[model samples]
Target: MLEVSAAREIVLRHAKRLKADFTALMSSSLGQVIAADVASDVDSPPFDKSLMDGYAVRAADVSPTAELTVVEEIPAGKMPTKTVGPGEAVRLFTGAPIPPGADAVVMREKTDSPSADRVVIREVPTAGQFILRQATEMKVGETVIPAGTVLTPATFGLLASVGKTTVPAYPQPKVAVVATGDELVEPNRRPKPGQIRNSNGPMLTAQVALAGGLPRYIGIATDREDVLRSYIAEGLEIANVLILAGGVSAGDFDLVPKVLKDCGVTAHFHHVKMKPGKPLLFGTKGDKLVFGLPGNPVSSFVGFELFVKPALRVMGGHIDPPTATQKLTLSEPFAANNNRPTYHPAKRDGDGVRGLKWFGSPDLRAMLDADAFLVLPPGEVNYAAGAVVEVLPINRTAS
Candidate 1:
């Protein structure tokens, strides 16, 4: 069995960043990663413009309590017909182009308008006052958005400002999730005495989306080889990654490994030495990746967090994955003597974290308040309150 760190390293070694495909429309490029530097088509502000509704005056001509003749009036989006000369001013609104020969602006409140054509300067004007200079934010042909930038709403607006209608970007990877077991039923159906509802399928799908991959739930597959083989083949064709929940342990009915091999997937490692998620199987066929997660819901969730989420992030060109481990103090005393390292569910308590109610890996209900995982090392351990331990944040806001 491979260690958790070793298995994760193997997965990342195979998860190469996608190449740039230069046809991503800005309309649909949200959450996509930029493949190349986006250059601005024109200077930001385009020309020297007014920053406020005030009088544009020659700086040398405006003195304290000096009167000046109004040469012209320029509103936003309009040009100034007359330029300000000596002892002259132009009445311009915000965003209007600065009239020639005018070096500063005085707000209306700072000036006394004795008549429509003349104004008294109550304050001395300074050069470049209330002026937004051309190319102040960005110049033409300069890089507006750098490579590897993730597209957000604000970045989208920046792209539009730079006249970038389309960008070279790497889109979210498509992931297919399917559960395998004979005693499984959909959530809508009432399970019989020997059956239970399938929560792993939908839960893994949600995890995939949270990890920046587009998830497609492929329903469930029974214990039969024929059915499992069909689902694996279809997932391989449609998705960049395929996650099969269950049928990975050493049972006679555990047919995921054999079926995946028959479908041309080359296994890299199987069975990680981690609690709640030991029966993880990883493989690849060409550029497509495959994962066989444990049947238990909590184990499946942990497997995605440790391995699959990082793979999806790599495919989407994201540098930071969700498995950000931090060392934090435990808020309460706890004891565990597990042979394997445990990632127990936890919630933030004040500045530290406290473990939640848990009863082994199958207790999916305990994960309801799980924002982080308290990493407990293997071997006999008794931790006192305020003991510092490793913590993995699954939900950033919750932690």
Candidate 2:
């Protein structure tokens, strides 16, 4: 059995970053990694401005008994006519440029005679108040964001603030999916006797997209060795990775292993000891990466979350993909052998996580409602309630 860390090394070692491409805008490049460091061309806010709507006066001009004449009014878009001097002041609004020689701003609330013509100071004003200095937000020639950073919505706004209209980001990976099974039916069609719907293909495709990859749905394949081989070959020709669902188990009718072996592919490992996806298989055929997931729906979900997400991250130019793990108390008790690690879909309630009722790998409905998976490590005794367990977030919202 392949350990989880060993499998991760094998998968990430083969990860190859896609070529850099130009994106229309920063928002369009969400989850894409930056290829180079981005620097601000000019200092943000460019000039000193006022942060409040008040009267800009010279420090000496403001006094408890002095009166000043308003020479000019400066709005946001206009500039001041002359520098402020003794016995002179300017009316300023928010975001307006602070006129030269004006050392302080007196709030309108502190002045008397609410007319706009002239005002008498009822209170002494502090120096250099309400002025936002230039380059306070960002400096010129400084790296705003380093390479390999994921472009989120906040990052996109920051990029725009630095006058970046277009950006160069790592290209999104393209994945081709191949679902193998003879008894599989389409989702829209009702399944007859002894037939099940082919959901792994669409499910895996959606997972690929959710992980920031471009999914190329290649449809279903028959159980025949020749048919599976042809589909695998086609998928390999077009996509960076080939994800083949089903046909890796010990069943005599499972022809995926035979077809891969016939194609001169080197099978890295055939099975893992993890629950819900023990029959997972990973290998390499020439320069193409391949993964054969279990037939069950929940098994496929688990396999993709653990095995495929990291590879997709590296291939998208991220040095290391992000993973969310937390320690949470179990709400109920459960029993299992310590030989193999177990991952059960769980829901977070209050301060603990509760294991949902599931029917093993075939239960997709139960898995859909789960926010995370409670990971029970190998070689443990009975897990009683209130025991702390490591939780790995499966749903993207939590992550």
- How many pairs of residues in model 1 come into backbone collision? 0
**Which tens-of-lDDT digit does each residue in 210-265 have in candidate 2?**
88888898988988888888998888889888898998899998888889888777
Model 2 residue pairs with clashes: none
TM-scores for every candidate against the unseen true structure? 0.93, 0.92
The RMSD of every model to the true structure, in order and in angstroms, is 2.2, 2.3
Candidate 1 lDDT over residue span 1-399, tens digit each: 888888999999999887768654554567778888889989989889988888999898777899999989999988878867898999989899999999898888898898999999999878999999999999999998898788888888898898777788887889999999999999999999999999999899888877778899998999999999999999999999999999999899999999999999999999899998898999999999999999999999999999998899899888665367988889998778889988999997868998888998999999999989988889998899999989888853211
The collision pairs in model 1 are none
Model 2 accuracy (lDDT, Cα): 0.82
